[model samples]
Target: MIEFVLNGRPQKLDQVDPNLSILEWLRTKMRLTGTKEGCASGDCGACTVIIGTPDQSGKFQHEAVNSCISLIGSLHGKQLITIEAFRQEPGHPVQQTMMEQHGAQCGFCTPGIVMSLVALHASGQPDASSERAILEALSGNLCRCTGYRPIVAAGREALVQAWSPDDETHPAACLVQEKRALEATLSTGVGLSLPDGPRYDAPQTLDELRKLRGRFPEARLIAGGTDLALEITQQLKTLEHMISVERIPELSGCRVEGDELVIGAATTYRRFHRPISDRWPAFDGMLSRLGSLQIRNRGTVGGNIGNASPIGDMPPPLIALGATLVLDGPDGERRLPLEAFFLGYRKTDLQPGEFIHSVRVPMAQPGQRLFIYKVSKRLDDDISAVLGAFQLTLDGNEVVACRLAFGGMAATPARALAAETALCGQPWTEASVARAIAALASDFQPLSDVRASAGYRLQVAGNLLRRALLASDPRHNDEPMLVTDYA
Candidate 1:
């Protein structure tokens, strides 16, 4: 049975459809209609919900996530907080500010906005009133009526206002109790077996996961269910047997061993954010643009690489950094370069009953340079049109080595062999960079899609390389490439 806490109440779920999404369970089964479903595919935030899970520091953490695409089976051993938990009629902090600031015109998107703001406050983070923090917190939410001005104002007001009140059941007090209640439930291990055909199994250890994979080779393995759950919700496909390795202690770890960073497969992007910023600061900007804070909270880096999406954010960086993958199966384990993991679009080198265990990335030497750039129409919560990752080592005025990789340019995120060859022994000059940019065309013939045309993608790839060159050149350190580039 799937046991969880629902708004300070203990709830046990069984005899429910394993394919049922959290949205369906909330709106239909529970008759709690506060959570609305705007875009069932997770684009609109009308169905946003807050889930309480332990953060990287092993403390209870609250995050806002899309409930439309999240499955009921995935809610095991966690706390589900919804809009119904708050009595807005009594002037809850978020609801009061939202109402006073005229944040809700249509009221359809209000619930999500309230929960999103609550999550930001619940994080115990400083400077939640900043414009950047408010924008990031509400990036996934769409309020067409208010035009986001009032909503943003309300978010700031919530942060600026003193939450103290005479009532014990006020929003602040309730939030404090919520965290304590959720932490109390964390000791409960996850294992849900439905009575019907479909079943959900969550293994706590790596050995148990390998055995489960061997026994149920046909079971669909899930890490975060960010993209995979769409198969059930959007495609209407039934996942009869499901196994998740999310809580496996071994797969969720990140450590450094002998000048190399070893990241477990189930490591979430949010957990890896600080480490990457401390170790490889170049990726910090691109990482922030990977997805919204909600998506990053639940989405895993290994999940991104495992899906083999051409536009995935992790592969290009791994390819450029010369990373390797470790896949373990019933027979044994094997290691290979990240480039070789993908054979084609949506195809991988994973054998039957085998899964990626961890990834090894070679740390940057003192003089090595790293660059990653992503291009999209919107800044946040949008897929990439083109993304590039490059690592270069120069010896005085000459290039000692170069490794380049790109996404959204081909069937798989792979290396640019011709581009790398062009810069291998060339001088670190504009002419050498131009030659290398020209070599990129021979490396990829990208397909045109809604995001960009084939010509635009190819040209953008070259322009990105040019930007990297200008940024890396020592002579251009004091100059700004763009007009708004102020430091």
Candidate 2:
């Protein structure tokens, strides 16, 4: 049995097929079709919906989630708010603002855009940085018809006219309480059955997850469905057994441990965004552009490392930061350095029955600089051409140590060993940067693909390294050295 709240109402699913995506379940099962499915894959944000979960502090935090690729079973014990549930009457404050600002056209994408705004409003980050914040929040949603001027205006207006605490509110609070009670009543602590041969299980504890996996060794351990959902929707493959790690409290927190930041395997990218972006401001911009906001809310760092995709975005930075991964298996737990974890393309040192439990990133020392860059065709909703990450420790006038890692330039997101070797002990100068660029070819033979030609990738990867060097130099002007104006 699986229980959750849908649009301010208690909901239950017993014989519902677990393999069905929330988008499918909403349209077919529940007859709630406000959430559109533009791209069955995770790219388009037409299926965006607001999901409210209890944070570590036990407060309800709402974030926009992609419903098309999201598994229905994953919605257990959470509050799901759809566009239809937002206002009691025809016009909510947000809806009225969008109307007043003329933000809607090709209304299919409006629901998603509105939900993203709802999430931003609920986040309580304030509107001091409203335009950039709204742009970043709505970046996942695409509105080809509208040039985004009115939508941005609407977002700003909504922020300006947001309701105070004393204003009359919707009845979602009562519904939330009632739904929580319903979930408690249906607490069987087991898996849900789906159509076809596949079975879906969500375990709340490590022992329970281990036992479930032990019973079904072929079962796939799913953290974020970002990658695995493609197996179902695109490939049309049915999983016999899937165990979601989202409910495991032990595997879902980011905490600090003596000079290291330990991130749980099940922690979503959204959960890590603030703290991580705060430490590395460049990452703040990258995090917003990582994918659609839906992907970040649903995807996890563990899923990225566990999948071991050559073009995976996070691995290069984590490897450059000297991170380590902890794996939990039936035998016990073991730790391995991130650099040593990847064995080959689509391969890792992870053994059968061994799952990634957490990743530990060592804190950087004083004067150490970390730079990450991703080159792609478009800034939003595109795969990387060549992604590079570098960590440099400067000894006054000399380079003490340098770690360089790149994705899409090799079979795996591995360190550019030869390039790092060239940069170490050399002065941080243009001559040293050129030597590192020349050594890139020795480290990896990049392939030509739809994203980029072989020569272009090599050139961009080299340029990224040089950009890192320039960005780190104190003598360089902090003012915008590079600027472009668009009509």
Candidate 3:
């Protein structure tokens, strides 16, 4: 049985299929159809909902998640706030403000827009820069009818009247309760055993998961359903056995140990945003632009690396930062460097029954300059044509060390060893930059695709390296410039 609090009401179910998505459960089963389904694979945000979870500061944090791709089995004992549950008595402050700001047009996308605003408001962060954050939060949501001007204005208005932290519920309390329930259920060996074979089962411990993997060697292991949901919804493929690893507490925390940042396998990208953003301001821009708020809320960093998509946004940074992957199977645990984790396009080094347990990235030393650039047809919510990460260390006038990593340049995200070799000991100058650009051709034979032609990709990849070099030189690119809106 799966039980949860849906919009201030406690609900329980007995005969629910584990493969059922939260969107399907709400729309088809419960008849709460306010959350629309647009671009059902999670790119579009028509199915946005506010999910309340605990933050690092031990406070209730609300964030937007795409319900369309979120499996119902994943919501065991959690609180789910849909469009129908924003407020009971009257319209919420965000909704009222949107109406006041004339934000709705055609009104098809209003529900998602409001849910995203509610999440932003719940964060208790109010600033003029929040306008951009709000826009970024809704980037996955397409509003063809409205120009997005009014919606942005509505977000600003909501910020002015944002709720106090005291008004929010205690998510930690809910977590404790859910944890107890989960423990009791696990003690009873309760699982989603269905008639057509077990498609999904969320074990509570690593031992149980390992045993299940041993019994069914071909079972699919899922952490975040961001990628697997496509197989179920688009491909219409049915797996005989599916196991979710999110419920395992051992695989869901981020901690710093000595000189390494150890991130658990199931840690969501949104959870790492604040700490990472504080440490690396350059990464703040890239991380914020990774995906819409909904996708970020549910997607995990481990899932991103495990999927082994060449166009994934996080791999280039992980590779540049010298991250390592920790994998565990029936034979114990072994660790591998991030560079060796990917074998080819959509392929990895994991053996059968072995899964990635965590990722560890070493702390950056001083005097190391880091830069990442993403070139896509659209600025937000689009796959990259070329994603680049550059890290360099200089001693006096000579390059001491360098790491150049890129995505969309080959079948997998990889470091350009040849280019790095050319740049490492050379003088940090225009001539050295030209030599590094020349080495790129020998390093990668990029292919032509709808996203970009081979020629355009090669040009952009070289220019990105030059731009990174320029951006790293504080004496050249650090000066403040004035900006004005012309009449």
Q: TM-score of predicted model 2?
A: 0.93
Ordered from best to worst TM-score, the candidate numbers read: 2, 1, 3
Deviation from native of the Cα of residue 241 in model 1, angstroms: 1.3
- What count of clashes does model 3 give? 0
Model 1 per-residue lDDT at 276 = 66
lDDT of 3 by residue, 393-412 (tens): 88876889988999999999
RMSD of each: 3.4, 2.8, 4.2
Which stretches in model 2 have alpha-carbon errors above 4 Å? Answer: 56-58, 87-90, 164-188, 475-487
lDDT of 1 by residue, 285-329 (tens): 777877777778778878999999999988998899999999998
Query: Which whole-number lDDT from 0 to 100 does residue 288 have in model 1?
Result: 83
The Cα local distance difference test for each model comes to 0.82, 0.79, 0.76
**TM-score to native of every candidate shown:** 0.93, 0.93, 0.90
lDDT of 2 by residue, 175-281 (tens): 23333354463345656885555788888788888777677777888877989998989998877678888888778878889988889999988888787766655
Candidate 1 has an lDDT of 0.82
Question: How much is 154 displaced in model 3, in angstroms?
Answer: 1.9
